[model samples]
Target: MKRAKLVIGLLGIMLFLAACGNLNSSSMSSSGTNGSKGTQLTGQSTDSNYEGVIENGKYVTSKSRGVSNTQDAGNQLNLKSFEKGLLNVSQQEFSTNKYAFREGQILTKKVVSNWLARESKSNADGLNPKDNGSTSATKRNPIYLQQLEEQDYMIQKNNKLSLGGITIGLGINSVDYYKKTQYGATYETKISKAEAEKQGKAIANKVLMRLRQYDSLKNVPIVIALYRQASDDSLVGGNFFAYSVNKNGTTKVKSWEKLNQKSYVFPIADSQTSPNTNDTTSFDNFKNEVEDFFPNLSGVTAQAQYTNNQLDGMNVNITTQFYSQTEIISFTQFLQTAAQKYLPAKVPIDIQVSSTEGVQSFLSRSENGKKFTTHVFNSY
Candidate 1:
């Protein structure tokens, strides 16, 4: 009888262990934590959802962290503009006052690479169209898709952080550049605005469907924006053309809202006319005054942003040959006065004064502000 009881106890223990193993496997599969580094969260209040969850006194980072995930390493300007522009676009749907920000934890590097590749027999997961044996730019199919970026939002409930929303930025190529043969001249394939919009929307729909397959993302609200990337030789980055929002548990994007946004470099090129004449004149006046004040300046230029054909903001970069601290300070003060007097008072303006050595001073004014705030960097 004693031997039989011992046997029964051993069998019961074996059954319990096996059951626990199954439970762990199920949890891993559902949470999508298999081989993931996992997130770190500190159970502390951030005072506001916009501030996001705090981890070790800092905002929580994504499971797949760092800048290695971003594509397009050739143009640093486009990369910076693309990332910042996406954040601003996201603010329209996921307001900072309500939602907390988090770097994307979903869509790993491997997943993104697959989605960016051309579809073929072996790679059914690829999103790009398969290559046909065509050398002509007019007949050849362009790589419409360029880069993918993801941002996640979180909401705190019952002292635990949960995924509240997500935003994805699809960088579509306006011009596809490639070489047909080894050591051959490069060719350019231009994609029209209408065609880009159509392809972007289609790709967005497919992305939504794939995302819904994951249990964690099935019911999460997602905002997807279509960004038209600037050409390789473009001086500035392109703007987002449209966006769509998919509500919880929905896999399809019903409709898209158009965005009327544009960016222009100061002193409009001879080939391209200014969109806003008054704004252009104001900037030109401001430029002339600053240049007159500092004759030893290397160059002065500005990048302006427009929304609905109205000036939204301007960033001025002043390159100087002066090195004296006093000279830098005086120029910065003069820039402030000139900017206020000549530049539009309705929009924010940022001025950076620099030399070959590095940044010398900075000046800025808030929208409709009466005064400018000045800061001069100190060298050790």
Candidate 2:
């Protein structure tokens, strides 16, 4: 079979991800003052619109966002739909990596909850009563991580889950409530990409460390990535910050790695009308359909670009490890058919299929006027 080139840099450390159970919850509480400065990342508070600021290694709500009525930004995300969507993806067959994938999903949610709780308690200064006849102040509502879109695993050529690499996408938002009134809700933040990356990495580390508490996951290599939420309904993952734990007996978490993508942005909602050429959302839909049609495949990672809001180029790569030789040929034919059916006819089209042996085949096709050209590389 044709050899495949590995693009992602795998850390030298050995990492494993196992279901976390019966682990000591003591070390898991980074919710303390001396634990993590993440508490300073409190959501909007009740006493004041501003929650707190980080001053000299401390969280102070005295600092403001330069707005008085900034207490409420928008509506709280109804997590019901988000949770249901996540559960749907989780239900899909992830081959040998299903459990770890599921754990990553749950880990992100739990850590967010814990981080918020810790921040609420640390903001005690905001909860103190005033001598001017003011009622006792309540703590700020907790911040949360929302819409964990999907978990992408790094599978080895042996058709086994790679212990050293994993990636998941999610959104960050905060809980805000009225001080005088009792109504409360959560809203997305307007923090810049830099600030969001910083917070995302911090939150990811919190979750990974907790995951490490389990004896099974102690030696496993893992990477957690966080992304800002999208404005639409689809699970279109976007720019992110990756957090990796230190290797070789080191207890420190490494610095965050910022990943930026400049491509056509597409709406999340799936549609049949002229595939949205403005962004890659239509490509994502095609990817979902491919997975649904091919049961032998675990997942498909597809991306595309647009120029002048027109289809410019595209690439669709899928891992087909467990499929037999017969299936691979059929899958290749399916791609050829798909390329002509969905992708722009005039643009260069590349569809790559990789297996446990290596890249099994590569099919590229393009058209000029009414004529078409095709190229195929296969190893059997």
Candidate 3:
């Protein structure tokens, strides 16, 4: 992370990504307005392709990259600390102290509630957290501490994170409208139910690893796991993805891929040869395939692990606590600008995140028995 003036450097990255050439795919290759490197950030809209908060009921800006720059940028949380970038307004008020967190930094904070520590420990269990007889298992009681210690380590790193993903498929038996009968229909969608989670955690890890590449950026990161669930959060089968299973146990994605790989570009689809799903499907085969050979994923307890353990790193202070969301609606462009406007200028690196399809649109159009598959999540 070299010093280039945070604002200008971020702008340079956006511009750079935009002009780098064809995006290499239908979605990437398409031309967009607000060109900011890969961000493709845009402004107020009159275009049909765009859809932020409508001015008169129509999109306010062009459908550039991320989301148009009007709405909130990324899923922002309450800031509590900073070791890397500047904390936004919302983050500063989330916790008791700014120095309370960072990537890999752990704490036994004073109990916010009796169930609070219990939940964090339950999340720490990862796959083995529960017993077969119960719907859930008992969780460890986390220590309630007023203070914490920090530990640091060094490792080889890369700033660039490249991502490629396939849609998640949940094979099921469904009705065949075309055949006018019940049939074994495999649906082909942009992102699968299971794949959305897989790719989300993977993408988070990829970006975190890229951030870890720099010695100057020793600040811990707040792993914000989310989904592109259409605006209606309830419609999603799973609200937000929380954590990735790693060697130690349930932890933030940053902890999962830490020291293991610099970047990961993978797919959501279990196999290139697998087929999609349809209306009548039971999701037995597809779910099994994804579950049997999937990465350690954060089902529901991901947020707790991230909030308590990995969100706070050793040297960097990422005390901010933002919850997850389904999509980056209007502010896609604004966020890119913000990214351009306020990235770590001294320690700048490009991060690209691509879902096979935008999270919002995937659910809006694919409900009512329709299936979606193949999602690509990338960070550059």
Candidate 4:
């Protein structure tokens, strides 16, 4: 077996070297932003184009784009949740069938940083409230807006892609965490839900007005979603509570719609039972079945998404002590069977099986689908 592994590694290296010969033949295109042009290697996907700097001839990344000057208050979980949730919301207004998705290019880091700063003598264009001298949480105005994200939607017309719409996500802090001095203890200023929504809408209006100043964005419809960020200590990120859209030629947001979306960790405490008891019961049965079969399993956990008080989707993670390829494959097959029998059939389900070596297998089923697609990674 050791000799076979050595042969396989050598063959892999040979194949990699052979593929390098085609590097010069790979086509490259020009991607322009504002007035500056950047090189974009022809990507494999024809569905949409990326907006960030190209990397490694095959990937696009934002690292070279620079970071926002605003102070970050949320963790990685919050950032991921905030961005993913915003994209989901945008899809409803800008359907994938009609519009091509693109990362935001209109709001540069410098522009976003300026908008997040407080209004002052030199920074008169700042969107945040002017800071008072007081250090008291209640007396001093808090930084309600933490981050801003923009997504652009493009439509192809006569072989050219043109901007069709824009979606903006506002991440508002629920609790402002700050300290008075370098060595002082941190304090929390909690903002009520109602207050956050109110301030978010006001900020959205201001953002819309500011965006309208640009000639290219004057006639494009814009969708704005307000997200209430979770506290600094929270394990799960916050949710988007409300959203509004401004139609073309409009500079003000007139109406808003409330979103009743929530996410819960599996096996929730009895005191904090979810309103959808059926999903909770189903997930509990599935967890029990898998654990009963694999006694040496580390744990099985799930993050369930609920929309309008109904189960929408779920992502389950299973950690195990097994590492052998055959064992991983067997466990994955059994888990798929158990999931189909116990989990909700109408909701999309994604399951990942992992060990100390990282992910070993994946299983997923789309909404209302009866079959699950399974894949077990090759252990080299």
Candidate 5:
């Protein structure tokens, strides 16, 4: 009886060992404590749903603490591999921005493709500047609100006012739908104070982004830089207050002028002189703006062009906004890539994104940080 009992106990132990041995080797290799160095997922993958999906490549640890068998299947959504070249924006937020360009929204690959491959470049939408029913003012933004209102009314009614003094009517719809909701594919993207605290990082970094080092990482604190639009200096300076907050939650007070685009020199400081820095290069690298940055620009060439005054108009409008939305989108992607490349198979990472540009009720119709609209109406 004793010998039989011993044999049974040994058999049970053997079965457990065999089960452990049967686990998928690759899965286990990239799993828990068993994963190798570079093979493990990084902190970025903490949010991955498939994190730690398997051990030894064939077994998964169930939420109930039981072991289940699974394949070494890779990402289910990594569908971009086979589909190369240009792709269609299948989603609304993506597609709308594609066919029609908007301010503040980051341009995606699909949007760029659609823009270049635009099927219709014709201004036949019945709203052309040359048309009888177009805004008459040569000045983009007229000084008087009444003039703007007048132009706005004309645009809605589809009536063209003479460039000099004549009235032409397309009898077209006048009210601009985009005027009401500027945050859509036609509006300037703005974030909220609360949201900025959350996702305004890369932007903040861009404000302080420099080509050289600013400080050591251990002491570096995340920054939230806000660049508000300011009026041009008139006969007298305006009164306004500014504030700077470090990573420790302490805020430094400041009194300064609101810097306008293409006219102001952004202040720069040495890493040792300044506090902790994120190592993001200032717009110096982007002498040309985002809407303007083309496929062929490098540091030396752009500088040469600037000296020669040959840079394009689009390059001139790059501003805080150009980097804000774009950097956020790229940052999220970088985090995901980093996580997948560094951490274990099962480690979890959750991202909480917030920004002044967070979802909102209204949007601005701005181009390169300026509000602009073109209404063309032709009456035969």
Candidate 6:
């Protein structure tokens, strides 16, 4: 259950520029202003029945819901636990640019995580040296202290820039319990959004308050966001509200002006789906085509939500039990080309590949009305 960090590019923009190497130059055919048209993919089908099953327009898989009691008893698909998914760390849409915190998204996550963990421990233990007469602030959480120490060492080792401001994304996990019905059926109980938001804000406030104690932290702006960890493994940003402190040395937190409501759209969420049956029908075909194209894959999970005939985002997660590195790289490139060609220009695409080595995620988005793919984050 190790947590992985995603590096945000400069200007608070999600890592959009890509270096996919000169991978598939000749194999893919460009179809003018749209995406690639013709491409032959090669993969031996692990499931013999799936070989010709998809060709008849049959779907072998169902939409993957994050919550399941029996299907995946161990919760092996949990993205956060494995640090599997790629995050758009430079979520400029969640915070206000009017307030400055050294612009780059790079190691700012360090600042947020360290500051929050320290703050949480201090408040819980009544060790606020400034407020109380306690001489030792050293009794803070060991995890936070370790992280801060590592961050400081890295800064000195690499001559890295000092931590300015940071956008802290907090996913307040909900505790689930089984409730037995009269018919002996059990259902999972999730905490209400209201309660989750309250808890998240309480956590964020503690982080912000402790952050104000340090001279360096006080000067830079801090945006604290609260998101609910959905059953579907998607991080929904701007759930209740996000808070930020001014550039000046002040602990006063104010609400962030901008919120990315579109980020909340998920495949299971009813409101987010397109009313046009054609969109769903078209997407189903696309899903089948992609899965059929990769016959050797152990399994494939694809999710997409369309609004008004436009795609907000499309995610394709695949697990190749065994494959050569060259084949994996070529497969990644092929998928990228397929997405650019088949999907709308504005749609954000996330392509994740999991293999024996680890998980690798590639994110793409539309920047300045131009399609841009995020640099791949390697889980080395």
Q: What do the candidate models score in CA lDDT, each in turn?
A: 0.74, 0.41, 0.23, 0.73, 0.21, 0.40
**TM-score for all predictions?**
0.83, 0.36, 0.20, 0.80, 0.15, 0.45
RMSD of every candidate to native, in Å, equals: 14.2, 18.8, 24.0, 8.9, 28.1, 17.4
Candidate with maximal lDDT: 1
For model 3, how does the per-residue alpha-carbon lDDT over 173-284 read when each residue is reduced to its tens digit? 0110111126644221234445444544544443344334444333433333232322111111112223222222212353421211011111122542212132002123
Off by over 4 Å in 2: 1-118, 122-144, 147-170, 173-189, 232-237, 241-250, 262-380
Ranking by TM-score: 1, 4, 6, 2, 3, 5
Winner on TM-score between 1 and 6 is: 1
Which model, 4 or 6, shows the larger TM-score?
Answer: 4
> Candidate 6 residues 289-308, lDDT tens each?
66677757765555554333
Please write out the lDDT profile of model 5 over residues 226-286, one tens digit for every residue.
2221222211111111223233222231222221222122122243231112111323322
Ranking by lDDT: 1, 4, 2, 6, 3, 5
RMSD of 4: 8.9
Give the 10-residue window scoring lowest on summed lDDT in candidate 4.
1-10
Score candidate 3 by lDDT: 0.23
lDDT of 4 by residue, 35-116 (tens): 3233333322222222222323433332214343234434556687887898788877876545655667788777887787
Winner on TM-score between 2 and 4 is 4
Error of 6 at 146 (Å): 18
Question: Which ranges in model 6 have alpha carbons more than 4 Å from their true place?
Answer: 1-160, 176-189, 232-245, 261-279, 291-298, 303-312, 319-341, 348-380
Q: Measured by C-alpha RMSD in angstroms, how accurate is candidate 1?
A: 14.2
For all candidates, the clash counts are 0, 10, 77, 0, 53, 3
Clashes of 4: 0
Q: Candidate 5: where is the Cα deviation over 4 Å?
A: 1-222, 228-247, 251-380
